[model samples]
Target: MIQDLRGANACDADGCDRALTEPQLVFETDAGRREAYECPCGAVTITVARPESSR
Candidate 1:
């Protein structure tokens, strides 16, 4: 099964299991894109994706 991982969220630093704010576009290219999600509790999560053509 193909799961959509982009919907995943970073847990808060307090361990409350709260979702972080929307991710910001940190980088991008013809090959892929990068995003950053920051929690008020100072937790940060970065995600990267590459197009199938880039493989």
Candidate 2:
């Protein structure tokens, strides 16, 4: 099952909820992982929460 655990790390604070454009590995944590995205206006970061069942 596909689940979206995206947070409010909204990109393009200007006026666009830019999706993860240039998704690059940013970091990882026991909770989940993070990826950085580049928007024409700026950059944003998002993290996915790991499901308890998977761990």
Candidate 3:
């Protein structure tokens, strides 16, 4: 789980920061798998694929 110490985007008035929570989901595709995190500001950040050995 992700932690939000400053109430999700404490720096901005709209509270659209992506670092406030964990990624929405972990997906596996033909190309690879990644964790997707989205913010209220329409910013989507995808982490690199996890190692197959770990999965």
Candidate 4:
């Protein structure tokens, strides 16, 4: 089963914008994870792999 993670830090492609507030659960997939931010203008982002050292 896939574990659901919430409020992970995310940023836009430009790297100029970062999620100011916690992200809401949107969905998850094998390719990556998706989350929605509080900002209405915000776009969904995919989460990459977790750091090996962190595990």
- Candidate with top TM-score is 1
**Model 4: residues >4 Å from true position, as ranges?**
1-19, 40-55
**How are the candidates ranked when ordered by TM-score, highest leading?**
1, 3, 2, 4
Name the 10 consecutive residues with the lowest summed lDDT in model 4: 1-10
Give each model's clash number.
0, 0, 0, 0
Clashing pairs in 3: none
lDDT tens digits, residues 1-55, model 2?
1123233334647677754444555566776665655566765545465656677
List where candidate 2 sits over 4 angstroms from the true fold: 1-12, 17-19, 51-55
CA lDDT of each candidate? 0.62, 0.53, 0.54, 0.47
Local lDDT at 34 for model 3: 68
**Model 1 alpha-carbon drift over 4 Å, by segment:** 1-14
Candidate 3 C-alpha lDDT tens digits along 1-55: 1233223533232655334366677787766666666666776655565456766
Judged by whole-model lDDT over C-alpha atoms, candidate 2 comes out at 0.53
Model 4, 4-45: lDDT tens digits are: 334234344454455445556656565554555454455554
Candidate 1 residue-wise lDDT, 1-55, digit = tens: 0123334544646665666556754687896877777666767777777877877
Q: How do the predictions measure up, each by TM-score?
A: 0.62, 0.41, 0.44, 0.32
On lDDT, the candidate that comes out on top is: 1
